[model samples]
Target: MAKNLLPMDALIAGYLHEAVQDAGITYRKLAAVTGMSINRIGIILRQESPPATLGEIGMIGSAVGLTASELVERAENVARTRQDYDLVANDSINEFPEGNDADYDHA
Candidate 1:
């Protein structure tokens, strides 16, 4: 399996994407206004390589007429929702591996 990464990042990205959708605006418009790129938008949406930076989020908030605090709060709420989803999806999840540390070098 691939290494596990925190799911909150993806949740935050999804929140931003949903906001754009709610505004009936395309990422291109946001891209032009915020000097962001469509390709990067996908990354932001997926919380992949192009995950949102604080500056990026601020720029997007400005374009969407959201206060900085409001935007951040929304992002946080979305992340929580995503966490809930992840918990449901991985009901039998383990947060860390179990093993005898002496067996091998651990990073």
Candidate 2:
């Protein structure tokens, strides 16, 4: 259930860490504020495990001065950036043959 929030782990961890820092809070403070276990917060911030539940994300975000939606968007942006790099690196953009475009009529 929590895993459904996002597919990527590292990006979300990065966002969490950055937000915590931006909010000028330590992991211990964040855990205290969010009512989450300090070890859980540490693990996620360290990229050992991602925060899976929306509830978890919301608590973390509230402590770090962001919203669950904002964090999700940040994670999505990171995923999109990674995808773009993967496509470019693999040359998938050129996978379609050069002559293929001519086979389809332009409206």
Candidate 3:
């Protein structure tokens, strides 16, 4: 059986939302700058749908003052953190018993 994975589209949308908020810009302004329709921007930012292409991501990132690479890198970091948490949560249960002095590396 395959393990369930979080959707990358949602992660990217979440990062984009945070970036837009941090930039202190409105959707109308972003639409105007990126030459994108407000509804399309809404779809992407709200995670109603993923952007159709890398060019769309680029346009959105540029409008929000982030490079495409930077935007993706940050989203990737978020994904990694979530994956790590899921793994630890799933695997660590009952691994440590009461009064057990097992040496473990905390790196």
Which candidate has the highest lDDT of all? 3
* lDDT (Cα, tens digit) per residue for candidate 2, span 25-95: 98777878888888888877777644446787788888867898898788777677775433132456446
lDDT tens digits, residue span 1-107, model 1? 43333464555566667777788778889889889888877677666754477787677767777655676676567656664455233644543456644655576
Among all windows of 10 consecutive residues in model 1, the one with the lowest summed lDDT is: 87-96
Residues 1-107 of candidate 3: C-alpha lDDT, one tens digit per residue: 52232366566677788889999999999999999999988888877744435677789888888877887787778768875433222545547665564555365
Distance (Å) between predicted and true CA of 24, model 2? 1.5
Error of 1 at 46 (Å): 3.0
Candidate 1 vs candidate 3, lDDT winner: 3
Candidate 3: minimum summed lDDT over ten consecutive residues — where?
85-94
Candidate 1 Cα errors over 4 Å, as ranges? 1-5, 77-107
lDDT of each: 0.66, 0.71, 0.73
In model 3, which regions exceed 4 Å deviation? 1-6, 50-52, 84-107
Question: Candidate 3: lDDT over CA atoms?
Answer: 0.73
What TM-score would candidate 1 get against the native? 0.58
Per-candidate TM equals 0.58, 0.64, 0.65
Winner by TM-score between candidate 3 and candidate 2: 3
Better model by TM-score: candidate 1 vs candidate 2: 2
